[model samples]
Each structure stands twice: as C-alpha cells, then as structure tokens.
Target: MYPGVNMDMEMQNVGSNGSEAAARQMATTTGNGEGHTHRGPQSAETGSLLQAQCNGGSVEMKSDRRVLALRGPQDSTICRMQKELKDVVCWKIPLWMLLLFLLLIMVAIVFITLALCPVFHQDVDEKFDPSTFNISRLFKGNFSLLDLPFSDDLLVPSSNQSRALSRDLQGKLTVVYSSSPALSRYFSKAEVHAFRNGSVVAEYRLTFLMPEQQEEQLRRFTLSREMVYNVLRQSLHQQEDHGTYIDPLSLTLV
Candidate 1:
C-alpha cells in the first residue's frame, strides 16, 4: 500500500472505534441507573422545541376563547331578533277572524242586554158600535096606560066605563091605556069640571121603550117623569096652535 492510503485507513479505523466506545459507555451508564441524569445538547434542543410547541398551543386556545366571546353578542342579538319576530307574528290577525270575533262580541252583548231588560204588555179597549141599535123593534110591545086623548068626540064618562085604548099612532107608535077605576078618578073629576067649563082635560101615564142597553137612558126615565109630561104637553099645544101634528113615526128618544 502507498503511505497516504495507509494513513487514511488508520484515521477511519480510529473514528469507528471512538464511536463504538462512546455508545458502549452510554449503554453501561444507563444500565448502572444513571439514565436522564446527564443533560446533553440534544436534550436541551428538544426541550426548547417542546416549549415553543406549548406556547403555540396556548396562543390558539386564547384565539378560540376570543372567538367564543365575540360570538356570544351575535347569538344574543339573533335571539332578540327572533323573539321580536315571534311577538309581531302573535299580534297579527286575519281580517275574517277579526270580523267574526266582532260579530260574536256583538251577539253576546245583545244577549246580555235582553236578559237584563224588562218587557211590557199593553191592553186595548173595545169600541162601541151605534149601528147595532134597532129602534123600530124595541117599541113593538104591549104596555099599560090610561087617560090619553083619542079624539074630541070619544070622551070617557065614568071610571067604570073607562076603556083601554089600543091604537097605533102614525103606523110606528102604539098607545095603550089600562082600565083601573081607582087611577081614573082624578082624571074623571077633571074631565067633568072641564066639560062644565066647555074645555076638555086630558091626562096620561106614558112609558117609552128604547132600542139600547144604555143605563143612562134608564136612569133618566126613572128620575124625570115631569120632563116627559112637558114634552107631550108641548107637542099637543103645537098641534092645537098650528092645526098640524108632528109624526110620531119620525121621533127618536135618544
């Protein structure tokens, strides 16, 4: 071999033997309970790298916390907006539903008013009908009287010879006379005295029948007998004065 080559070969052999010896010493120290006691350059470098990684992790955790904190306000805003929208929706009503609700309220108010209010009933009086009265049919009956004038020639002489006169006057009025001797005494005496004086005296008991159910007319008939006598006397006087008589058929009492 050449000298240079021999020198290079020796250097390589020395390097290999040094590395082997260092590995053997490390293994022996680990076996003898001296592991992790010696801090080498590699261990120090590895510790620095691990500390940098831990600092990066802490920075990322702080950024995450900042993001979560910022998101809290956004979340609250969104919740508030949603609540407002729900409130608006709850207040809204359809037109048909609103109208129906108003109608129901009106009906309930009417029902309550009807239940509380009072009701009244009124009565009416019947009216009187004057056309139902028949005057001709009422006077068609037999009645008793005496001492009415028949004619100038037919004069009654005595109480025993007094006759009951049944005569229809003017085809509508009927005059009747009852023959009672006791009732005719005063009229007979008056007739005899009037015959001596050359004048005829006439007297009468008169009753009028009316075609009505009125109590007022019956009351007048019962209370005012002089009124009837005056009316007859006036008629007879008018007949004597004018030589004309009013028709009894056309006369109406009421």
Candidate 2:
C-alpha cells in the first residue's frame, strides 16, 4: 500500500492482493457459462482457432463446457462438414455414372431386340405346283417360317393355318426363274409326292400383302423377305384336299 516499498515488501503485497484480485475478477465474470475462464493472452493455436470459428458465429454442441472449449465455433464445423461432403460426392460420382451407363445399356438392348423381332421368322406361306414343282430345293432350305435363325419346322402354324401341298411331296431350297414367260424365276410349286417316306402333316401361311396405309408396312415385310416368300408359299397351301380355308386368324394381333 505504501510508495517506494522495498522489493521484498512489494512481493509480499502482491501475494496478499492476488487472492483478493482473483475474487474480484470472479465477481465480474459469469460462472454459469459453460466454457473455461479466459484471462491470459491465449496461445496462437487457440486464438486463431477461436477467431476462425467466431467468423461463422457460435454453435452449441450439447451446451457442454468440454464442447465449447474443444470444438470452438460453427465455421470450422462447417468447413469440416463441407470437406466430408466433398469427399462423399467425389466417391459417389463414379457410381452415379456407372448406374447411368448400365441403364443406357439396358435401353439399347431392348431397342435392338424389338427391332430384330422379325428375325425369328414371321410366318409360313407355301405354294404347290405339279407342273413347276421342285422337290429338291424346298426341303433343303430353312424349315422355319420365321426369318430367325432356327429350325423352320419348329414354328407350327397356328390352328387357322391353311395347307396347299399334299403329304406326298418333299423339296429343297432352290432359285427357280425363267424367261419362258410361263414361269417366273422367283418360286415354284413343290411336288412333295416325289418322296415315298416323306409326308406333309401340316402347313402354314402368313399374310404378306401389306396394308395400304400403315407405318413400316413395306419395311417390315421386305425386311424379312416375307413378301416374296409368302407368294409362292401360298400356292403350296392351296393343294387339293389341303383345305385352303384359313381357320379364324389364330394369332390375331388385336
């Protein structure tokens, strides 16, 4: 308390006042707060951290003392959150692209499959002619009525199928055309009777005359060679006792 005091006295005075000064500082502060007291110049690490967090304002992490002191404020939290989000999206981008690629592939496959529907052979049309009959050619070609790559015989005509040829004939696949004016080169009647063992149990026919007005009418038929193939095939189903009367359209689209 006195001026010009000796060093020892000054030291003793400081020690005595220390306790009172601490109590007064305490009275000036609010003890109910969660964080610890901040009296001295904070370390660089803690100061910078606090300022950065303060820039983004405060946040209450469960309103705990430990959280306020350790976690600091919201800016660092937002920065950390942003970093984590960036990491997650970076990893997710490839997966998103992969899923998109897979979906595209599936769509392409479906489109291609629908486009190739006629490849399984659309229908059978046959013609029989004793005069222009060719036994060897018709039997050798695909037995399938569908243009698809399969055994032609597998496609059993629907119940409404008409038959023109007899059980008596057998034939092969051959190109038949001539300038004789009596017979064009495209197709001929199949004299299946030439074979003793071979026989015609059933016949099939597909409608080929495209609708006058329809989308892809000519395209569909021509795409499968159905137009020309059906013409000659129609004649074979017209055989005597073959019952050319087509039953009700068995496989009606509608």
Candidate 3:
C-alpha cells in the first residue's frame, strides 16, 4: 500500500474510536443524570449537559438521548402525581355523597313525622260558666216520708245520734222483709219525723256499694216504688205496739 493511503486509514480509525468513546461517555452521563433529575428544576441542568454533549455528536444520537432523558423520570413523576390525585378525588367524592345522603335521610324522617303525626284540638263550650255553677242547687228538695202500718207507738228518732238509730232500723227492716235477700245493702240510713196528726214516719236513704257496676245491677234488678212501700209497711208493722195507726192511702215516693 502507498504511504498516503496508510495515513488516511489511520485517521479514519482514530475518528471512529473518538466517536465510540464520546457515545460511551454520553451514555454514562445520561445514566447519572437520570438518578439526579427527580424534579423540574433539575431537568434544565440535565438538558444543558445533553445539549453540550450533542454539540459534536450525531443528530439521531442526540435526539435519542433527549428522548430517553426526558421520558424516563418526568413521565414516571407525572403518572404518579395523576394517580395520587385520582385516589384523593375517589376518597373525597364518596365521603361527600355519604354525608349528603345522611342529611337527606334526616330531613325526610322529620318531614314524615310532622306530616303523619296527629294534632288534637279540644272544643270548648262558649256558653258554659264555671264560677256561676252551684253544687247545693242539685239537692234542694227533701225526701218524702213513707206512712207504714203499726200496732205500737212509733217514736221519732233523734237525728243527732250519728248512725245508731239508722243501723237498728236497717237490721229490723232487713229481718222483717225476707223477700229480698240483699236488700239491706241498699239502706244506708233512716230518718224519723213526728207529724201534727200524731203519726211518726220514716225516710230511708240509699247508698250504693263499691265498684259502680254492682250499683248499676242493684238499680236495674232490685229497686222499685211498690217494693219499697211493701218492705217499709211490713218492717214497721213488726216493730209496732198497737197504739199507732198508719194510713195506706198516704203512701208516696219522692
């Protein structure tokens, strides 16, 4: 071979070796830059280093380096941030919806209770007056005395002796008239009075036993005007002494 050809071949070999060494150095620098470039501020430094290396490098190699350097860390960071934002949104949306749903349910319950609940309004009589009412006006009349047949002097019993005369009269009346077995339970007390015609008459008052249902039964089944007159006539006749006379035509009930 000629001396010039040998020299040209040697220069080509040296240039190819230099290009290989530059590519190796650029690759090493790109790896180190990727480790350091974690944020946006560090990207400018990495880009500046790659641009400086690309000043003498091939166009395709420089473009490939730029693509690799920008794509690796930046895309990974952007994707991670997007995923975190999506997760935050997912958590917040459900929480807000749940709170709104609970509030709506509470509102619905209150509305239903108010709508369905009953309202009572009591009616008052406009003509009624409480202060003008008198209880004593109801008992203005006196009880009528029943005239009964007798054979003995019928003395008037004193009204001030509590219940002694009344109880004795009740026992005599119950024992004399046996047609009614439970008649004694109705006679609460008796009052005696002397008339101008020398006639003594008795007025018997009634009282009901406890539990008002029993009182209703007694009033319905046991009490009558005729029955009272017969019982009083028989009872008085049994305790007579033949000195008194009772008129049967004067018998009346009040």
Model 1 clash tally, residue pairs: 2
lDDT of 3: 0.47
Per-prediction TM-score? 0.19, 0.19, 0.26
Top-TM-score candidate index:
3
**Of 1 and 2, which scores higher on lDDT?**
1
Error of 3 at 50 (Å): 99
Best by lDDT: 3
Error of 2 at 70 (Å): 23
> What is candidate 3's CA lDDT for residue 96?
47
How would you encode candidate 3's per-residue C-alpha lDDT over 1-254 as one tens digit per residue? 59999999999999999999999999999878985665465565555434223422322224324543323455667777666545533446654466567899999999988876744433343233334332211001122223533223334344443244346545554454444444443433333333222343444443323224344544455544445556656555554644323344444444
lDDT of 2 by residue, 73-184 (tens): 5667888766654553344565445556789999999999998997865543323333442222222221222112222332333222222223212232122212212234
What local distance difference test score does each model get?
0.39, 0.39, 0.47
Candidate ranking under lDDT, highest first, comes to 3, 1, 2
- What RMSD, rounded to one decimal, does every model reach? 32.0, 18.6, 22.5
